[model samples]
Target: MDRQAPRAGFTDVDRESDPRFYIRCLDAQHASAFKQRYKRRTFDLLELRPGQRVLDVGCGTGQDALALAAAVAPDGRVVGLDFSRTMIDEARGRSRGKALPVAFVRGDVHHLAFADDAFDRCRADRTFQHLPEPRQALAEMVRVTAPGGIVLIVEPDHESRLFDSPYPDVSRRFFAFRNSSLRQPGVAHQLYALFKEFGLTEVAVEPLTEIATEYASIAHVAQFEGGMRIAQRYGVVTEEEADAWLAHLAEADRTGRFFHAFTYFITTGRKPA
Candidate 1:
């Protein structure tokens, strides 16, 4: 793959039309930590097996894709897709020289470049939230899945992150970001509804929860702080305000007054046999 020319701004205006800005979260090392925290949750939701074909939408660095590749060893295939060229490059590099056979491509999740009923099982982890039209994406996931195949959409419900923190400002700032990104998790409950709306059958919804005790070890906290810094760096937020928010979160953790928890909704449905 050729190196795409970098744009001037941090975020791409095309993100509203294209799924490019999500790479901000995907191309970071912190994503690996978050993936670990939710590994069991995602795997339980997938319920994959050998000789099965899987498609991992918004595969990021392809860690989840690699895991699926291992599950379908020898016979099964796993294809990972991301909209960002940088992420696809990293993903390809990650699977380089690996015995497992996997394919990584730069493509939009909302508009996948595949024929109908192409994959046995389709998954979009933490991808729908970034979508402007999540229901359309959900429908597409089901469309690309073979009949009787499973389509699973997994995401964190930000509303479930209410922690009883001693520092009020910590929760406040966190909630600001959460509230801004509210649309991402808002569709969690609607995923099943969308699945049914798209004529899928045997639909089901599952919830997974995890708690973080320490801030330093907490991936979400780190991600929040880094994102805030990015916003500051890009003039989205003032540096002083970002510093105050960071101080609050750090202080909350140091004083052992921090409490953090996230709930993930895994909604799955199967096409008619």
Candidate 2:
């Protein structure tokens, strides 16, 4: 099956739908060393300690949950929550017979099942952008975390996505259409202010850039061709223009000028004691 979904894939996940496509995109991104560097940074920012319970919201395939479980060893535990049953099942299957201190549950981020001060730390990676109410989700994340506990958020600024191409005008239109499909493509750029609004102290933000030098390296994850198909479908760009943009990207790769980069913001804050 084609790994790319017909539309932007992250905001939807179901067994009757394209679980494989969504999972493939995640796996590809996680497999990249460039992506792994930032993933590790999140771990460091969380400052995982022994015997400190943690919560991972929108925990997709559970790779980060497993790692978090390992980080908080011995008496500590990690709760992985997602809205998709398929994702929960996939997570459970991977964790079966493993000695990791983690559990997967299906839950809504806007209304987390956990109570106040339930966790020593809370985090959501690449989650807020898909949420219609990112503030509510952040409130819940902050509420569950105990005083002095960390609340970390990771998201990409979609407007920051840049692909070196000849058609700059068409590229802007294409990205505009693409960003419109997301619930909040600019969520990453808003976290600092949101944290302040929620009374989270010591707020900090770090911007990391993920650059793809090869067409094949990013096409599967970014859905280069599949996205163009949708763009043309929506009349955001004409067929000839979209095709030309794609061809320009390909030629850039052959000429060693290919460049695709997106900026990810890692924002973290501490709930006041």
Candidate 3:
């Protein structure tokens, strides 16, 4: 699928202005589960060593930040930055008196406030899709990373999925719905070129395949439906279309043929020494 035209950066309004019920709906629809999956991938993608200073751009809730600190023990620091105060507050609350040397700051990814060559490594996961200018954020990452330091980026390829369902149409619609909400199209496909343009050498892209069979249940389908309803409230899609599409998937899932597999892009690049 073609990438959509780039739009404005993600605002707190988009995340917090949902109707109360809509937000509740999303909470019930696997947000925590999604985050758990993301955390695992982030930890795997970030290869940390002791005494290595790291920066986590768009570090929501700071779970990955904490993990990175643990990996780089005894003299390393992990600086977590995000645009949301609420998220930063929660991260700090969790880290209070931990003595891990993890610091949470409120900041924007597009224009980071840090000295050049300040970090031994930088990472961003699932955060690039929402940015209006991903390249700008990436360049900032490159600027802050030490010479020969690694920059790892990970994002899900929503347009590409493998599903085993009694109803093939449901799987097709699922893929379409996911692509519609992204700020840019084909983000997974463009990683290599973007890294090259930013002068990052020795770039490597690894695609992760996910296989989850539990998605075939009625409960899971309802959870996804709830999230779609909230997405419509945010103008990501029309209410009628989102509702109808979810109903179709619900049916397929009830029939016990539910399986969905999507690939994630894990691209690593290094700034020249």
Candidate 4:
């Protein structure tokens, strides 16, 4: 696959066009201990049963799909789909040498290539924020799931992101700049209502919170740098201001005062029988 140009800023870039960067971000997310814990909670909420058919939309590198395969072992199967062929290729590569019932395909969530009621369960994680039409994606997920089957959606409310810094103005500018890049920075908080509006039953929402007192624990090293660079690019902050803000964060980390917290919502509903 041909490599795409490096992103000029944090503004929405087609992840499919930059597979390497997308893969790196996925790797960083997998390496975070807090993120792993949250994923486990999501899996538990899925309540997988043996011999079930599952679909993981925007499965990325198949980490979660592999786990889902293990849960539905023996007779069950999982089909991991992504719009990026590179991501699908990476997911297939990762599944090698494992005797699991998992398959990867390149496809779009807005127009799933599956028959109605084709899956026992369906899920999409951290994907809705980037979509300009999240409701359409949710409708497709619901359409593909069997009646009484579950459809799970997980997404972060970027507007709720918070970081501890002495310079309140800088922090505000940083978050505003970051949120501007997302199509729906506050979609997670609206998922429950969306599900209900789509006529799904038993809709429920849960907030998964992460509090990082240490800079490393928050996995903000790259994020901080990226946000500042984007802020500067978008004229939200000056280069000098960005540098000073980063310096303050570094000092806080060294002094054991660094803090960050964000909450993501996991919303699930069942197709009416």
lDDT of 4 by residue, 1-273 (tens): 212223332123244456578777788788987679878888988899999999998898899999999999989999998877777889999999999999999888989999999999999888788777889999899999999999999987778888888888989877876676567789999999999998999899999887888887654434687768767877788899999999999998999988888898999998999
> Stretches of candidate 1 above 4 Å error?
1-34, 166-174, 181-183, 219-252
User: Evaluated with TM-score, which candidate comes out highest?
Assistant: 2
TM-score of 1: 0.76
Provide the overall lDDT of each model, using Cα atoms, as 2-decimal numbers: 0.72, 0.88, 0.72, 0.84
Candidate 1 C-alpha lDDT tens digits along 197-219: 88888888887775666776555
Stretches > 4 Å off in candidate 4: 1-18, 219-222
RMSD of 2: 3.3
Model 4: weakest 10-residue lDDT segment is 1-10
* Each candidate: RMSD: 6.6, 3.3, 5.1, 4.3
TM-score of model number 4: 0.90
* Candidate with better lDDT, 3 vs 4: 4
> Which model is ahead, 1 or 4, in terms of TM-score?
4
Between candidates 3 and 4, the one scoring higher on TM-score is 4
**lDDT for each residue of candidate 2 in 1-273, tens digit (9 for 90 to 100):** 222224454666884356766676778888988779899999999999989999999999999999999999889999999988878898899999889899999999999888899999999999889897998999999989999999999998998899878798988888887787788889999999999999999999999999888888877667677878787887788899988998898789899999989999999999999
How well does candidate 4 score on lDDT at residue 267? 95
- Runs in model 2 deviating more than 4 A are 1-7
Per-prediction tally of clashes: 1, 0, 2, 0
Of 1 and 3, the candidate ahead on TM-score is 3
